[model samples]
Target: MKTYRSLALIIILSLSVNALFAQNKPSHTDSLMKAGIALTDAGKFAEAVAIYDEVLKASPDSKPVLYEKAITLNIMGKHDDAIIILEKLLTSISTPNVYAALGDAYDMKGDFDKATSYYTKGISLWPKDRNLWLNLSVSYSRQKKYPQAQAAAAEAIKADPRHARSYQNYAVAAYLQGKNAEALLGLSNYLMFGSNNQSLGACNVIKSILYAKPNTNADPVAKLEQETIAGAVTVATAGKTGLAPIDSLVLQLTASYKAIQSQENQFGSSFFARYFGDFFGAIATTNYMDTYTRFIAVSLSPQDNIAWLKAHNDDVKAFNIWLNTQKRQTE
Candidate 1:
């Protein structure tokens, strides 16, 4: 599942949790499951476990109950318990989704080998389940096994050409494998079909490619603007684009300009909210906001856009360096 989908499901589970449990004087198995789901959503895993136990006590081998309990246990960081339940469930209920969930649990436990094992099992059981390959790729990435991760994610793309996570996973793996062109292609695909900001991957690549050159002195503003324009054109073609990062940079730029011009530290987070909120996926912490503001103070100093970019070029360089060293997601 996409991270956002998991978040959305948690929201839906929270809303129906109490209402589902309150009906008919206490609960049915469905009601109890809803209660467990709700508790899990609320981060009340222990309470959810009690509800899950109530169902299991009545029907010791209830697959649904077992699965729910396993998920809740994993949520509580109790991976071994969850894995045990998942293993038991496998005997009576063997399916792709189940195995995916099991693989996720194992991954969380830092057992990538076992995680990929279950993911492969899931794939064998349901070859068309594109998600299985994606999950397997993620496991491989976590282990720093870039080549294997790339192969699995590529399989996911072949299985379902439009699968966004497949591209994202593949891009990360390719980058780790030092296949810059492959990474760029996958990142472009992600921008078009997955996350709107391909810059999360692309800017770093540009910076790396630029930085790796000998005796190079690329104009910072021109380089950034050029890369930004190219990335924007690539991403803004359809419903697949997002405008948060630049929108965020603009707000920061303005705030720093105000502070520098007025010499009066007057702007508040409210200004950031007005612009940054429009682009960022979530509200940033005060510390992160401060860092951006500080960046602006340094970057916008000369009032010459070129000077500003040159002064703060290090931030871009740093982010690029970080991305370069990031291990593949599945390994």
Candidate 2:
């Protein structure tokens, strides 16, 4: 359950590279930067760095070149060198992207403390930057600070509700903290965006949680998890013998959503209670639970679910239509 796979570094680095190229107009240096990026993509880090250096020789202090070079160095495992370039960039330009790159460098070097520091600094400068919050969440999760990780992920979600990785980070933290219900809710939300290795692992964990006996712990969170699991189990077993795995899953999830709805008053102002509750609660009330079930199940085995999805293409389209009409709560 402690499995925390973060695509933040690579994803953010790619975004930064693309953003830099997008903002600057065409020029000789721009062409070089694109070439360097192409080289980096081809795993020719040395060649990419050489190209960046060639650009720097002509336009010294080129922010884009410096940033791209640092990124290349990071890919080459030259974290210290990356840090030096990023630090110099910070002295001249103060941007969340620079701070993010520096954090990535420190994180790659296995210095979670330094990485956390830079991510926190970036958040202070640009409080709404979802990438900083998301990366901070990753650093905290790596340090096994589950509560802080969850909180940081909440911020990331608040900043950008559509960012899939934030939900994945939140799910990992919540699941490791024994908050199974919250983890499932986060996983459902993450699957809405796309599937990946981490999301697939989470889907397996969701199955395990649904199948496990109810938690009898006295902790309030455990109690809620117990309630949710009980609801799922009861729905799955009641007069429904030999149900297919996907059918059982749909029933369990529908029941779990109902369980969450039952505790809406108890959930108070927590983000999961307020946001995830409303979103999934709506889906639970719809005829679309089967579609949603198959939708998420696709993450587990895309090939296996392909025929079913193809057969239910119209249902999928209707679900998407209904989904587009649903408004997500960010606050």
- Give Cα-based local distance difference scores for all models: 0.56, 0.80
- What is the per-residue lDDT of model 2 for residues 207-282, given as tens digits with 9 covering 90 to 100? 8878767667636865677677677678756998888788888889998887776676574336777788888888
Deviation of model 1 at 182, angstroms: 1.3
Please provide, for model 1 over 1-331, each residue's C-alpha lDDT reduced to its tens digit, 9 standing for 90 to 100: 3353344224323434234223232345777777777788777879999998988888886666677777677767788998899888788767666687788888878887788889888898888777678778877887888878887887787677666767777777866655443454455445434223343445445335322322124344223323433343333333534644444443433332222223111212232223222222121322233333333233223244345446667764664464355333211
In candidate 1, which residue ranges exceed 4 Å CA deviation? 1-27, 194-331
Clashes of each: 16, 0
Provide the lowest-lDDT 10-residue window in model 1: 263-272
TM-score of each: 0.54, 0.90
* Candidate maximizing TM-score: 2
Which 10 consecutive positions of candidate 2 have the poorest summed lDDT? 1-10
